[model samples]
Target: KMFACEHEGVTPDILVLGKGMTGGYLPLSATITTEEIYGAFLGEYEEFKTFYHGHSYAGNPIACAAARGSLEAFRNNDTLEALKEKVAYFEEELKEFEGLPHVGNVRSKGLMAGIELVVDKESKDPYAPETAVGWKVAEHAMEDEVLLRPLGNVVVLMPPLGIPMDDLKKLVRVTYESIRRATEGKPHNGNP
Candidate 1:
């Protein structure tokens, strides 16, 4: 919906979609466009206006079957509605970690979130890149059996959408503990 709204004017000549399109099971992508674009290539056989592009396995029947089943599951089970409720609960729980000593901000939408960490809250000074604070937090989380990835000093969370509320709570808890462990006793103001 957001993409449609943002690209309203530019009637897409080609639409390419991949990653999470089929729930990330089998790596597949698609290109879709109006018949008008396809008709543009309707010319003499000698004419070289035909655009040709192909993947090694462009139309694997099994992948198509999986995509079809996934779509049906989405409609029949209202997976999106359930996801909305879960994301709402998750975001509300994430808010509890705000205002922590090293946590600069918590921003989230749907099932994704980024927790930015800073050395100082007043000036919003990020930890030195050499310190690799985000990496440390991610490593600590892994030690606690919570896998996480960091983008720069921002800890990103993209947990599975269907995680139960209890597991979600544990995820948040482990994330908080990991951050605390990483930054604890470290000088926030670059002083001893």
Candidate 2:
């Protein structure tokens, strides 16, 4: 969303925010409508024109209170501005993997990043789906204490907003080492 707003210059008419809005402290999501769209839903109550959507815990008092506190923390801490700096450093730190074999593309947008693995760099040939190459890297990364989520051959990194630089660097190092070990001919445990 930040990438779309800042880099792509796009503004959404309606936005859906979820768990991350409360920093995962509660399960909640909100569908925010633009003024124009919201106005469309507005009419005389007698007209029977209304949008009714609710969940089991839709307006739970505890959850709503926590979410408000979370939003205020973000505003007070200047989280967004601080995130830009961390994202820049995180992207730069991962440059260590650019020269590694099978390291195809390093992509980052705001605090999210993905390292795409490939069989042939020039041709950008991805590994076989059944090979589970990304999973291997993620499994190996856990050995180095950095958890990653992989989509096919793309290993994704999305650290928390408050993670320190040293920790982020550690994540980068672990990720690089994991990919390096995963792609090498010699196996880490000598199994294959």
Candidate 3:
């Protein structure tokens, strides 16, 4: 299904998009289709067959305005180009912690990243769930004035798209410190 839907010359009958569509400032999504699809329901008044799906905020003017402004800013600032460079730098800097004593893996795409912690690097075994290693690391990061959230045993970083290089460095440093503090004096047979 995935391959067929994504392959060349194969167009989906309906396209549903969500998440980051409005840069996550508001809750909104869209179901887009071609004019042909819409024409199928265009008929006489008595024969009208309109779909019935609604949200209280559907067609919200404020959200539409925000989306337009965000798109404009993206184009005016060449945000995609800038992100291409920034993401490359981010990935390189993030990888530096790969062999840290408690760090298991670093995975990143664009400006989003996840740092996994492990109790045994060779075995790639995660710390006990009850240990709350990820949660503790996030708390320590907050203490350092950097916010992070944990997904299971992985610490996820979703920094803003246009974060400055200096700030990015600070983020990496803070993450390292957070991990160290969270696991300080604890025995782990990981990266060492």
Candidate 4:
């Protein structure tokens, strides 16, 4: 889906988009709101209801061009439409981690996913922060030339939208191996 809210059938009052706005080519952000909300700020000169907001790069032309280019590429290449197969493959590949002894949860949307690691699957107990279990798993992946970032005990996987199937498979395989090396056969008593 283009956005998660659209898929959930919820309309947001305000939507803030960044990061992928320019496909990481430049820093750009956009705030979108319904026209009804925007019109509320309009009034006579004395109404004193003007919304004043400013930022250093608020309207940078270079960033705007990059954002436009990203949108054009999305439309021309049918990016979202093309993701159907990839998304299915991603979901299927992610199933491999579900039965792992240390995997607490696997959540995904589009090309982004998070694998939550736990001390005990039955109890869903989290490892102590100092244990850095997530970081250890990431390190193991890095050894195989696959970069990963951790959110506490959750290892995040956010690959590029245009990644090939072969690379996606490798990403999952390396991540699975990393988790195994980091958690399997290890005591989860909470000490690093």
Candidate 5:
């Protein structure tokens, strides 16, 4: 999609950018808004309409340069164009999770995806937080040299845009194995 908002044909009043903005090489964030919204903070001091948002880490020259270079790499390498094939392949690979016994949902956009694990597929009952089922899957994945982060019972998989196809395949394969090992082998009720 051209923009996340554009996917739904909507324009948000405010937008925030972080994470991949600097290609994960630095810490940075940005706030973007429509001109009309900016005008709201343009009034006189007595009006008390000013927006006084600031942070000590708001701007760093090195981070800005990294962001610029990251953007240049995107353009120079046609990264987005190249991502189409990878995203399609990723979606296909993710289908392997849907048939897994404990996976209740597999949702994705672009290269980012989450596999939601459930205690019961029919009821979609989530495992208790103490179970740390997500972490269990991650631990298994780590053994295979694939790092993943889990949000509760949902294991998130977000590979780099420039990740090679072979690595992407391994990521999915390892994650699939990890999920199986964590959910299918033994009873994990209230345990890791």
Candidate 6:
């Protein structure tokens, strides 16, 4: 919201938000749209044009309460402001992985990052699905006590918003080590 509304000076007509809304507790989401968009749905009920879209568990009070709590937590901690140093450190630390042979790309925004591993670094050919490249790196990371979740062939690093500096560095180092182990010419299914 801040990035779009302030940084880019853009206002979206409609915004659909979920996942973090309920603090990952109950499955609930909300759609917020401009008055102009809402006006489009302002037809007579007799015309049966009332916008209708919802889930069974929509507007659950418990979930809403959790979401409120999450918001409060953010406000109390000023989480974004506090995470600046940590985010920068995480980014700088990620630079080391670029030297690795199979590291195709290392992209990041704040705390969310992805390290793309490639079979052919020059051609940027991604590993086969059977190779499970991303998962392999995550598996190796887990061995070093760094929990990782990969998005397909990109090993995604989404640490907690306010993770400690030490932990964030560990995450970077563990991720680099993991990618190295996965792509250092080790045979998977005897496909050397």
- Global CA lDDT computed for model 4: 0.87
True-vs-predicted CA distance for residue 168, candidate 4, Å: 1.7
Per-model TM-score versus the true fold: 0.75, 0.87, 0.77, 0.90, 0.90, 0.85
Q: Which of the two, 1 or 4, has more TM-score?
A: 4
- For model 4, the stretches where C-alpha displacement exceeds 4 angstroms are 185-192
lDDT of 3 by residue, 22-124 (tens): 6668777778778888778778778856766668877788777777776677678887778777778888888787867778888876777899999877888
* lDDT for each residue of candidate 6 in 48-134, tens digit (9 for 90 to 100): 778899889888898889989877887788887887888778888888878888989998877878888888879999888999988
**Which regions of candidate 3 deviate over 4 angstroms?**
1-15, 33-52, 185-192
Looking at model 4, the pairs that clash are: none
Better of 1 and 5 by TM-score: 5
What clash pairs does model 3 have?
A: none
RMSD versus native structure for model 1: 5.6
Write one digit per residue (lDDT tens) for candidate 5, span 1-192. Answer: 646777678999998888687899998888889999999888888999988886677798999899999889888989889899999999998998999999999999899998999999899999999999999999988877889999999999989898988898889888888899899984333222
Ranking by lDDT: 5, 4, 2, 6, 1, 3
Candidate models: Cα lDDT each? 0.77, 0.81, 0.76, 0.87, 0.88, 0.79
Ranking by TM-score: 4, 5, 2, 6, 3, 1
TM-score (C-alpha) between model 3 and the true structure: 0.77
Deviation in Å, model 3, residue 102 alpha carbon: 2.2
lDDT of 4 by residue, 47-141 (tens): 98786755788889999999899888888989888899999999998998999999999999888999999999999999999999999998888
* Superposition error at 149 for model 3 (Å): 1.3
Supply the TM-score for candidate 5: 0.90
lDDT of 4 at 96: 86
Model 5 misses residue 33 by how many Å?
Answer: 1.0
lDDT of 4 at 56: 88
- Stretch of 10 with least lDDT, candidate 2: 183-192
The top-ranked prediction according to lDDT is 5
Error of 3 at 29 (Å): 2.1
Candidate number with the higher lDDT (2 or 5): 5
Candidate 5: where is the Cα deviation over 4 Å? 43-49, 186-192
What C-alpha lDDT does candidate 6 achieve relative to the native structure? Answer: 0.79
